[model samples]
Target: MRKIRNSEELLGQGDIASRRIVLEIADRTLDRLDSYRRIRSIMRMEGSVLHIGTRSWDLSKKRNVYLLGAGKACNHMAMAVDHVLGDRLTRGVAIVKISEETDRLNKTEVFVGGHPLPNEEGLCASKKMIEIVDHAGPDDLFIAVISGGSSALMSCPIDGISLQDEIDTTDILLKSGAGIVEVNAVRRHISALNGGMLAKRIQAVGAELIGFGISDAVGSPATGDIAVPYAAYKSTPIGPDPTTLDDARATIVNFDVADRLPKSVVDYLMNAGPDKETPKAFLDNTYFLLNTLPDSCIYAKEACEEMGIPAIIVTSFLEGESRDAGTFFASMAREIQSYGNPVKPPCVMLSSGEVTTQILDNSSIKGHGGPGQEMTVSFAITAAKTKGACLLSIDSEGTDGTTKVAGGITDSSSLKAAAGKGVSLYQSLREHSCFEALSAIGSTIFTGNTGTNLCDLNILFVPAIEGGR
Candidate 1:
């Protein structure tokens, strides 16, 4: 992370410059939503009927093919699979909350579902997904698309569990500030569909499982997800302060107390025990690291450089509570503008990572703001009130949270909205109400689902001119 120095002077055009920085940030974030990198990761040669990951089986025997996908990126992954090897896919189904409105796959059916919270709709689809993979013959192939929001969006609870229980546990884990590992650790035990629950399902179906993960978690497949991570713990949970969402746990079904999760899943989560020797069915399949956070960070950084600004990828995963992380990022931007040490005069300290906002008060409201947008505005307010630096943050996916405002921008004028409304910026943050401030001024960025989930991005732009009108 580089720092830049700031010496305030009255620059009449400062506002325009700030606006450019903000728009550029939004455009660049959306531009990277290209599907090529993803398609390439899941793509293969035409006519190559052979499996993608290492084959656990001897190549001599031919196998039936059955495909299944579950997650925000699953359907898209399914589309790419069809492109790579069309007509080969026997049958498949996918779950995507938003994209299902238009996702059209020749062989795969797209089911619309909810996110951050699973609904009856998603649970129902997940059941059929299990059946698709379950019927795979010992010689059949199963490709599971595990991505960022899969845990919640693709919830197919076990026989004894209810969707409400899954949601409740999520609430408890999130409010507890538990990292994705602990959260998922607990989730693995609660659901019959996660923590290798699906793998176990595949085994029973006698299918060879090939997981294609669009890991939304920080550590990629190491956490057991290319996009979900069931293998690594370098993850720092998004610690939202004390919240009311804790109530979500009150619904867990009783039998969840003791369930024997797939031993392989448990061992993998513990980061111990060797992988299962390929059961005769899977003797022909294995896993692969198709993508990770670093890939998207590099892409964003290059775009910033092209804009003629110095760029440093601060961190691939800046995980922590929103307020604390916001404060830390605020200080970093101030250092860049006032000191010019880690980053130079005209630079954008770009960042990509996850942040969680706990249930502050369910009794109140959804707060009209997402943590990503709040962070951008929060950093701007914390930036020494000087005239040089500008901060803009956006969820790469286009939808930041309960509110659809992808993200927001901050500059000297950010405080104006609240002041105009006779509400202080500090008060808004106290209430988690950045939307009231950012939206009033038209600085909040919005682009319906960018279709890419590399997590969120924050950019701090240091300036050549410290003062701007």
Candidate 2:
């Protein structure tokens, strides 16, 4: 459903045909990856047997079928499961971010929670989920739905560790520029439900569990190197790998987050015993990866080709500082214009991955924006007068960081427009407050909640005709 709310206004600001093509690609990508649509195609009941991906379950043999999930997109996933299970669904619960979509589910009990950070509501929801898993029996089957934001959306602190401690630790790690893998490594150590702990809890009572996940983290190829020549659909397990603890410790020390972490967090990590560690494996359980960032990127590329635009899947594993990545893309655009290298002009260069922002320590720099916005602003500064180029940077979840705005879009005229408004684009980037500056130039994008998350999508569109600007 109209995920990009300001599409008409946004398209009006840039080269119309180019904007339409890029936005259409985004729309089709989201539609192709919609949780409900994907779940329906992948999961179905054939007679008494429920089929999910490459696995099947004999529902006739189960005592009860329960649904449990948490994430920004879990509500949609839950709804799809509820419809599929119908009256056979005994009970269901999902912890979701607070949004207009909260009350849409009828069968599943949906609890509103915080995102990007855990709050009391999430804590309460976590307790309910734990109770559900704790009460499950061997005859029961749990269909767990996990997606992006599940780590924070289902925050259950370990004993002796307060919610405040978990919150403080999360804030420190996020601001410290730790990637999701590293942050989740630490989270698995600190939480009661992360890693494979949830599976452990379910299996402890001899209950059967199967997970359907929309992966937001970069996947591995077993060799530990990033998977290359990205695949549209791939499945992998979720758990605290054997190396998780060591990685978490390294991240904390390497980023110097230990000193700034809460005392409880520090003590837990420092004194973490084998008993407190998340298990590397959960026996007799299975997890299926339904979709991912790479999947969406591939879909976008196919859409671009259908529209007669040569598209390049630059990299699906984009990472590092947001402004730096923006600058790099801006430079690439310049190169394409000047030398016609990198697939020449009139091509769409697409990349998918989460970027980071290193917030300044100075308290006076009170700016609010997410990595996507910062990236767009940075690109605007670098590609100030470049012609026939437009960039759209957005977090797939439709909410970039703490702001309601999804992200920002920048065209060749973006910087000029900002200047006309007497706004300093570079100053805004320096303050990490791009929302206001982008808003001043009608570049801020708004999409309430896209009902999905697969990291961020950055689209660089150069018109098919040279000098289109």
Candidate 3:
């Protein structure tokens, strides 16, 4: 299936050659990262045995097999497991950021959970999952498929903290300019499900847990051998957490969000002792690492190579302010086109990581947009200097923030196009309305539930100058 839904429209305008190359590479890379296909390839059933990666579970020996999942990509991950287990699966519950009609399941109950923030549906689903785990005995087995965004999608706050508190905390931290690691540190410490609390719950009930996870943490190294059991798996609701109470406290102070956050949450984290800390390790559970943030860049590089285009994986650890990053990428494009500093022209620069947008005052906001949209808009302003320099920035899982589109694609002509359409890209960036601006110029990219969540996937295509560099 085509991942980029508006490919034809995108190709009809602005640096068509560069847009075509970027879209093709992105589509192919997204296909390669589909968790549903990856899970199905490694998991199967043979009579009474369940085979997942290098391990096999004897379902006949177990009393019940339950599937529990939550994440942006949980739809695909959980569907793969639900399809394989079929009748053997006692029950399944999956919380996803978005639920589509294409999803097929027999026993699993799907919940459309909120991402970037927790919602009532996610809270209800979390309670149900807790009930299932708490009822489980030593004879039961659990298969957990977890990915990024599980923190918000599987929201269950600890004692004294209301669901509103969690939501407010998330909203505050996200706009505070703190990195995801910092945000998750505070979030995981206060949550009942995230930061390995679900695994801890399963452990308390003496249930066997085998987890299939995709680590979307920025700077995470590329995954090796998906078939081998990964021992270092951490974070999410299904695995042990590396974040500590100290880390949580440190984040609040570092980001200076202590005064703004809910007082109940502040008191809990401040006074909670060693007993309240999240589980740091799960020695008994089995985990398999699927894909990581670095894998996105690696896959994109491979896609470019397949098309005979030289690609440079500039960095998979891209972070910082979104608009600023776009400006930097545009500057790099200029260098590559003019001086050929970073591998010369006719090359693709691939990068993946979580970039954030800071919004201190909600009243200043005008329209909808995310970090990826902001980045491309910012790039368009400066990319006007470099001819044929095209850039594509998408959230990778399809939705880029408030907009339904994945992200935006822009090139040298984008600035002119926006000016002609009476869409002020500068005003859009100032008002944080990149989506409206990009949409007005026919530059927005759309691909729903891409089956992978690796933060941001940025591809910059800098074609060689008209003549020799």
How well is each residue in 237-317 modelled by candidate 2, as lDDT tens digits?
A: 134345467777888898887779898877778777777767766546666656666877888898888887899989889
The count of backbone overlaps in candidate 1 is 44
Task: Give candidate 1 regions above 4 Å deviation.
Answer: 1-14, 22-26, 33-37, 41-45, 48-64, 100-102, 219-284, 364-366, 421-423, 466-469
* Candidate closest to the true structure, highest lDDT: 3
**Candidate 2: where are CA atoms >4 Å away?**
101-103, 220-243, 360-365, 464-469
Report the C-alpha lDDT of model 1 over 217-249, residue by residue, as the tens digit: 665432222332223222111111111112112
Superposition TM-score, candidate 3 onto the true structure:
0.99
- After the best TM-score superposition of candidate 1, give how far the Cα of residue 128 lies from its true spot, in angstroms: 0.1
| Model 1: worst 10 consecutive residues (lDDT sum) | 1-10
CA-lDDT, candidates in order: 0.58, 0.78, 0.92
Best by TM-score: 3
For every candidate in turn, the CA RMSD to the true structure comes to 8.5, 3.7, 0.9
Candidate 3 Cα outliers beyond 4 Å, as residue runs: none
Model 3 lDDT per residue over 1-469, tens place: 3788889899989999999999999999999999999898889999999898888988999999999999988989999999999999999999999999999989999998888889999999999999999999999999999988899999999888999999999999999999999999999999999989999999999999999999999867889999889988875788878889999999999989889999999999998899999898888999988899999999999888889999999989999999999999999999999988868888999998989999998888999999999999999999999999999999999899887899999999999999999999999998999999999989999999989888899999999987634
Ranking by TM-score: 3, 2, 1
Q: Give the higher-TM-score candidate: 1 or 3.
A: 3
